[model samples]
Each structure stands twice: as structure tokens, then as C-alpha cells.
Target: MTDFNRDALGPPAGLVATMRLLLVEDNARLAALVSDGLEQQGFAIDRYESIDGAEHAQTIAQYDLLLVDLGLPDGDGLDLIRAMRRRGNSTPILVLTARGGLDDRVAGLDAGADDYLVKPFQIPELAARCRALLRRPGNALDSVLTAGNIVLVTAERTIRVNGQAIEATPREVALLELLLRRSGHVVAKPALENALYSMEAEVTPNALEAIVSRLRKRLAAAASNVQIKTVHGVGYALFAPPAADE
Candidate 1:
């Protein structure tokens, strides 16, 4: 197991909103504990006690991360990693097992695991490793979203424009994030409403409209090169402003 001196911080709210993880471990107690810890950090986790179970689950759901134990009840976890890589699944995988030998670590990496953690590891350490993997370049999950001169740091829930940081209300931040995620594509008004407020929450009819309007003005005032385009009854899209010539 790897140890760290400092405690690990939980993932940011915006990053956690979309992350889904698959944890394949046979020990029910450990699985439950790890699942709870990750959930508190804003992750959605699915647990599987055997290699066969995880294999089946992967066919139906997309996961942002995978935590696999080498000593599975049915088969070696490396086989699952190999299979996923063979099928072009690039989701980051972290091996969580009792295998502490140097060769074991090398084998795990060679078998397509992004990082390896031995048994008895701290939950915070595990979570930190997971975060590092997701932030890796070329991975489907990124810690930041960028459009022109505007950058949204998903982990910190902060926005920057032209190298300057800007403060935004929670609602405004949520609205901008939803549009930024679907940049260059239309995000329907209904979807925007859902993103801003929960289904059970009582939302005023014009609540979403108000949030969008405020965010639009803030972005413009900040001189952000990105703009949010309203699609009338449809929705909105975030994108770079058109060239002056166009």
C-alpha cells in the first residue's frame, strides 16, 4: 500500500457531476467502504464482486474510471483490463490488490492499468490516484473545459477569461457549465432547466431564463471571447465569437 503525508481533497462538484466509476473487488466490506468514500467525493460507483460481473456490466454502461482487484473470485483482473484495451476502451483503470511485489506493479502497468495501489491503502490516497488518472491528457474525462479565451476549471468550479479569474453565482456557474459542456451544439431549454434545478425542486417559470441572462452579461463584461447563443424556444450553445470579417 502507498502512504501519503497530506490528506487528499475531494473532487470538485462540477467534475464529480459526470464521473462514473466501476469497482471490481470481491471483499464485500472493503467494496462498501470504498464506494461510500467515493460517493461522498462526488463520484458514482458500481461495484462487482467477481470479474464476470464487471465484464457483463461494462457492456451496458460507460464508466469514467475502473478500480480492479487482481485476486478476483473468478479470474485475474488483468484479463479485464486487457480485454477493455483490446476493444479500444480507454477508461483509466487503477489496480487495487494485495499484490505488492515490484513485478506485480510492473505487470499491472503492462497489462493496461493506469496506476496500482496495494491492499490496506487509505481511501484518500485511492481517490487522489483516481483523480490523477482522469486528468491525464487524451482521456475522455478532463478537469477543465475551454472555449476560446474562456476556461472552466471543473474541479475548482472556477471560470477564467483572458487569464483573469471571475466570480459567478452557483446558478450562473451551473448554466455556463452546461452550455460549455455542449459547446458548438444546441442544449435544449428543458435540459438547461434540469441542469440548474432538481426535478423535485420548485422552480419559477422564468428562473432558468434569469440565470442565463445574468451569465451572458457577465461573460461579455469579462471580455471573454466565447459567447452563449440563445436558440429562442430551443435552448443555447456556447462557442467562440465569429470573426469580425464573417
Candidate 2:
């Protein structure tokens, strides 16, 4: 049994922003390689080497896709799949395993995997599968968040202005995504800090402000239509694009 929510399709023709994915693989080397490859294609990944960590992550965060390996130290990946399905989690799951036999594939699908890929797969093939999975109706985050000519593809961690690519660091990209996601609304500074940095990060005072300042400069230099408007004591917001006449 195999499930295909969307047709077998390759990545989109042109460059587009991507979405987030949760990868549950116990092999450290493989996970690092896969994460790096996927990130190059614009996806943000949160990886877990054990089933327990992944299960805990599921309780707090939502992801566009799940890239899971079959075997884990704590338990079989099949159990996690079954639990997620039982809990009514419809997030698209793509199983990556060395188990290439027909029976293994059948069991994975029967247990509720959305797609399956045997190990020793190419990065291109994996990327294609990811694109296809996200293309399914309601299976992905908004592909593009735009404020006029400035577009933020949160999934791809890409920023573009009038169709021109503007280079962005990972932190800047993450910050841009947060602002763009709530473009018209205010995002508190504390929330932005949390979104940009993990709890354990040793942050200095005004560090967030410095990051925002740099980001603003980048946006301006690129002639982007969107602006990051700071509210002094309050948080920041992605201001609506200027009117044509203005």
C-alpha cells in the first residue's frame, strides 16, 4: 500500500520559497547530509534522531511535511505514524527507509505514511517528492508572502524584490519570515526573539535590535517595497507596501 496525495511531479520550474519539514532519522550523518541538501532547496528543517524527540516536537510545532526513517532506537517509526494518524494528524509524511521490499512498503503505507522512499535515494528525487507533497491542497504553508514587490518565501528562506534575488543569512531569513507571516499585524519583540533564537542562546542586550536594523538596511538597499516598521517600545510589523501614487 502506498499513498500519493498529489501526482508524481518534480520541483517547480522556477525558484520559489519553501516550507518547513520535520525529519526523524536516527543516523546522524545521514540526517546532516539530508538536512543540508534540503536546506539548499529552501526548506527549514527541525531534526530529531529519536522517535521520542520527534513525538515531543509534534506536540508543540506544526510542519508542512514529515521525513521519517523506519527504524529508531526507541521504537519503530511505524508506531509514530500510527499514533499521529490516530490523533488525527493529517500532516503529510514521507517515509525514508532502507527497507526496500514490497512488504515493508506495504506495511508503512498501511500504518499511515503518505509517501515512501527507499534509502540510497538522490537528493533531487527527495526534493521532488517534497515539492509534490507540499503541492497537495492544504498540505503546505502559504508558498509566497508578499508585501508589494518584496516577497518572502518562508518555506524557501528566500527574499526577492521585483523578481530579483536578495541574499539573506539564515537568521535574517527566519526573521523576515516571521515579519512577513504577520505582515499587517504587530509582532512583539519578545516573540520575535523567541522565534529567531532558541532558549539556550546567550543573547546580548539590543542584539535583536541590531539584527532588525541590519535587515531593514538590506531591504532598503534592495529597493524592496515592504518595510519593517518598529514601534519603539512595541514590536515590529511588516508595513503594507506604499501606494502607487505615494
What's the TM-score of every candidate structure? 0.51, 0.50
lDDT of 2: 0.80
Query: How big is the positional error of residue 147 in model 1, measured in Å on the Cα after superposition?
Result: 28
Query: In angstroms, how far off is 215's CA in candidate 1?
Result: 34
Report clash pairs, candidate 1.
none
lDDT of 2 at 189: 94
Query: Across residues 13-34, which tens digit of lDDT does each residue of candidate 2 receive?
Result: 4444447789998888898889
Q: What are the C-alpha RMSDs, in order, of all predicted structures?
A: 14.8, 15.5
Query: What is residue 37's positional error in candidate 1, in angstroms?
Result: 0.6
Model 2 misplaced regions, further than 4 Å:
1-17, 136-246
> lDDT for each of the candidates?
0.80, 0.80
Query: Which segments of candidate 1 are over 4 A away from where they belong?
Result: 1-16, 136-246
lDDT, candidate 1, 18-107, per-residue tens: 468888988888888888888766667788888888888788777889999999888999998998899988999999999999799999
